[model samples]
Target: MRGTHPSRRLGAGLLTAGLISLGLLPVPAQAAADTNLALGRAATAGGANGGYPASNVTDGSQQSYWEGPLGSFPQWVQVDLGTQVDL
Candidate 1:
């Protein structure tokens, strides 16, 4: 009540209740933080096709994709996470 708008508080509580009832809320998630661990990290690849550097994969954009040189078999790309993390 103090420093709080009644309607706003009610609206928030109602929304939370609705989401929970609809099963849209994942309460008490037992997992690591949902995040892109490799975004903007240092990356290295066997090779690239023109502008598609190894960093493209870790740039966090689906539209932009990395490509290996043509006719290259078993191409590989590596991203450094700066530290070990749970997969």
Candidate 2:
């Protein structure tokens, strides 16, 4: 039977030690719950094509999108989260 290489044995030992240390480490407490606070919320855009409205930005549908007019400079979109959130 062939013996395992010294480097391979050392690598495997380090990997095992790392995994065991990670398991013994204390885990952080869960932060605030995760939720999409932007769903169905109010949204406004600087400008849009005739048919496309600013509300489409938060309609939760990729098929629909707000179309800004051509040659419009400094266009932007904004969403209201209804409440201030801490970053």
Candidate 3:
């Protein structure tokens, strides 16, 4: 009991496909950038008492954790945009 037919169906299908194809564009171009500074400062003498590294220490110790051996860990940690991605 179909009515108007295959021609109408074909036209509708093509239109739908075209619209969907056009929708597949608009991603970030510049990308995103994130980095961890990884800072560490030694604990103030025995103030650390007994706890995590000076960096994670929650006590009120004068000794703080600052950046540690740069080479030992990721130094400048960076994220390049690589290439301008198409959106």
Candidate 4:
């Protein structure tokens, strides 16, 4: 019976480890908003007419986040209630 060379076996092990590590990588949260809810408009910076309110815009704020192309993709807003709360 033939067996894989020591180097080949090591390479395979490394490859498996790499794949597992990649899979374990943390994934960013993704969000989607309804058209009628004005979520889509806010994603594009087009909701400046106080649709959602200027003070409500979080964008680069520490609480809310907006990602991806200027117009494409959904806006991501992460909210913390200071503590867990049931809605």
Per-residue CA lDDT of model 2 for 1-87, tens digit only, reads 999999999998898778767775443333333555667999888888888888888787879988887789888889899889875
RMSD of each: 9.8, 9.4, 17.4, 12.5
Taking all chains together, each candidate's TM-score versus the true structure is 0.58, 0.54, 0.25, 0.26
Candidate ranking (lDDT, best to worst): 1, 2, 4, 3
Stretch of 10 with least lDDT, candidate 4: 31-40
Q: Write the per-residue lDDT of candidate 3 for residues 1-87, one digit (tens) a residue.
A: 859889999998898778766865443433332432222323332223234343443233446533333335342222233445553
lDDT score at residue 71, model 1, on the 0-100 scale? 97
> What would you estimate as the lDDT of candidate 4?
0.46
Report how far residue 17 has shifted in candidate 4, in Å: 0.3
Query: Any idea how many clashes model 2 has?
Result: 0
lDDT for 46 (candidate 1): 94
Best by lDDT: 1
Which scores higher on lDDT, 1 or 2?
Answer: 1
* Model 4: how far residue 18 lies from native, Å: 0.4
lDDT of 1 at 8: 97
Over 27-68, each residue of candidate 4 has an lDDT whose tens digit, in order, gives 333322222232323333423332343335433445644333
Query: In candidate 1, what are the lDDT values of residues 17-55, reduced to their tens digit?
Result: 899878798765434356788899999999999999998
Deviation of model 4 at 45, angstroms: 53
What is the alpha-carbon lDDT of model 2 when measured against the actual structure? 0.79
